[model samples]
Target: MQIHRGLLQQASDKGLISAQQVQPLWDFLRECEREQAHERPGFRATHILYYLGGMIAIGAMSLFMNLGWERFGGWGLFAIALAYGVLGLALTEYLLSRRQLRIPAGITACLVVVLTPLLVYGLQLGLGWWADKGHLSYRDYHTRVDWRWLLMELATLASGAVLLWRYRLPFLVMPVAVTLWYMSMDLTPFVFQDQDQSWALRKLVSLWFGLLIVLLAFWVDVRSSRRDEQRDYAFWLYLFGVMAFWCGLSLQQSDSELSKFFYLCINLALIAVGAMLSRRVFAVFGGLGTAFYLGHLAHEVFRDSLLFPLVLTLIGLGLVGLGIVWQRHEARISARLRGWLPEAVRELVERRG
Candidate 1:
């Protein structure tokens, strides 16, 4: 439930609120939404720069780590990361306590979380136990999936959990979700107990791991107190969850038409689930999957057939017509559907919302 500028206009048009009151009311509500104690910030110049700078710093130090970093050796790497982390934490505390710049504070905290894996990796490197699988380069850490990453991933998840618990900051979920995704790939070898694992098995791991994250996201969504304007803590979880699940589902090769149709049906079900949960990510993924399935049929099954495209165009126009009808009768339709649900189920929905 969000109150956009149009809603204010609607109230003025209906005489529910005087025209004189609208501007001041809108200004106050906008401020409330911006400064809501537990809510995330909206897009603004300061926030944009904060995130951009943070991301650039994260990318430089982590994702784009060069072999030159190894020149420092394990102890030197550990020292540099420790210095950066301590400085980041100090700045975060200062911002929170003195400047009250919570957005920057969150970014600074996230920087420390991002640095944790590198710090832990350095520690592993110093120890003799580091796998150094295939003598892989640091860049391979991101590109290649290997069991050697387990220690760093575990440390990252642990540290992220602690920081999230301490600060109640939703930004921490980014690192946690990323580490979980990494673990989903890196753990495949250990799970299979062999090096000759297939791509199908890897995708299968990702699919279930993604489902687990989605379930966790839903649970968090239901329990979050900052539900206004869809500024949810579950946003990153949903984004990555859909990515993993959709990729895995798309990778499967099915020769049977019935199996392909079943996949289409599953995607349609995802769209319905999106509507029920009021989460747009589900709808986005579901719609894309449905479009892909249709394109596959048009090309692979009905190659050189003009009839299918013409039918698809008609179906597109029909869907637009359905949208208009839906907009006009949405209230009545929703009320009727709600009435049909059992009392317990309706109550559950209400409570969850």
Candidate 2:
């Protein structure tokens, strides 16, 4: 689906178009691709550096948060967060006012979303709502699974919504998805009555929450397709959705061989779903589950048997063969499948792709 400039030039040389027309046509096509969710943020060196810097900054604030940040006390933390958030918003406004910098603008808007939890944490400390022992650090927000983390997560989602309202930046949803994923785990205590909640119950909550997230992502994907928006509002949703679903599903206990086989089959179905939807997240999770299941079989069921390796090898070769066949007739196969789908479903797929 990628159009190389070389191919375009080759076509021009072959008299498909005059030499003067190629550059304009390439520019037009590139613009169209840029507007789609799957294609923007092209891999130029500058663009790569842009995302790398953005990710490092985001990680410093969220993932690798320093515990010393809590030492600033509630008011001091609030002041810092307020300063950073305001600065980020101001920069976002400036970037958006110009036509050439949507990516930077979106990243700046996302910083507002990232600062939500810090602001909420400050408020909690100032109001004496959080533990005063200073045992909870910003790092614990991600590492420790506790109900005390709910306030920050809630505030994050709210801020994400507000940012999306003001900016309509799809990258804002990444924080929303992260907060929701945390909520799925943190809400476990409230969902169950026992002080010592069972892992099974937790897994069930995760599985259901993941399924819900996936459904929401699919809805957003469809909506974005309908709207012709290229920002990819569903990317975070799909990423976290599969993480939750796959983890939950993998953690389940299957006592019988038939049940284990069923699990493997479901993973295979997930791989197929990935192809059908053209979503890599599905394939990544599905492939991981399949490999884990195979490993389980190798260690637990086929420990002394050599036959299993032979079977696995044959299965691998079969998959390679299948790939070859798919590559050779992908267009025909896609068209045939399209013929079988209902009108609405086909339209959605067309819009999404």
Candidate 3:
């Protein structure tokens, strides 16, 4: 189904398109391809390299930082971070405006965002506002969950928001999503300052925060769909939101079989929602959760029960049959689903589909 210059030339040879029209058609196609490349990131080797390099750089500064670097006092760290931000912004501008390389520009913009927390950490330390512990290292920002890290997280969110607004790049949202995930944990202490902060409390906060983020992602998705925007700004939000939600939900302990079955149903609902939205992140997490519940039943509730295997096999086969039926009637089924939605929502879903 792919059309290439060779196909156009073949059409020209067949007298389908005039010789002069072939070149113009090919040029239009090429321009469309270029515009799509700018709007949507692909899994091309160069794109993979860009993401890999950006991740390595981000990890080096954040997750991989060691106490050795802490020797660079507050002002020193601030100066280094500031320098990186300035240089990164300069490079981003060059790549985006001059070279027209959006992927590299996005990566550079994300680098500046990744430095936001470090910049805030240095600022707090130098200004004496960070008086919690004399030996607190900025590295602890990732390793430990303290209310003290809230300022840095807030600063990161602000910096990411500003960058995203100015550049309108999807990759810039990655840091913002990560910061929100971190806040889901760090906010625990702030919520229960002087009380006995229980693990259950933390899990509840994470679960709610995750739901909030997912709702936010859905809103963004709807807005983008309504605008016919090709860029996916909600991808990282969905991913991190699902991670937080699923991890929190999975960590809860319950002896009641009803609760376990409820968990399975929730995951199944997630799969259905994923199908509705055309989002793989939801389906992936939902699949993992479903597998976990099934594993639990097989190992614990139905160990050595011959009926369990038979039932599971029947269910699997039924799913395969259902998949076949769905494949045969996917268009009709999708249309029916859209018909069940309101007009505005249907339009959004159709556009996304």
Q: Which candidate has the highest lDDT of all?
A: 3
Candidate 1 per-residue lDDT, tens place, 1-353, comes to 78887898899999999888889999999888667743456676777788899899888878988988988877788899999999988988898889877677877888888888789878877774565445775557788888887888888888888887776677878888888899888888888875886888988887888888998887677667334333457888988997899889888888999988988998898898788777788899999989999988988999999798889889999999999999999878877887887664455355545
Task: Give the Å error, residue 149, model 1.
Answer: 1.6
After superposition, which runs of candidate 3 have C-alpha atoms over 4 Å from their true positions? 1-31, 194-196
Which residue pairs show collisions in model 2?
none
TM-score for each candidate, following the candidate numbering: 0.86, 0.86, 0.90
Give the CA lDDT, 0 to 100, for residue 77 in model 1: 81
Per-residue lDDT over 8-84 for candidate 2, one digit per residue giving the tens place of the 0 to 100 score: 99999999888998899999988876665333666778678867888888788788888788788887788888888
lDDT (0 to 1) per candidate: 0.81, 0.83, 0.88
Sliding window of 10 residues with minimal summed lDDT for model 1: 223-232
Q: Give the winner by lDDT: 1 or 2.
A: 2
Give the distance in Å from residue 57's predicted Cα in candidate 2 to where it truly belongs. 2.3
* Candidate 1: residue 82 lDDT (0-100): 95
- What pairs collide in candidate 1? none
RMSD over all Cα atoms, model 2: 3.3
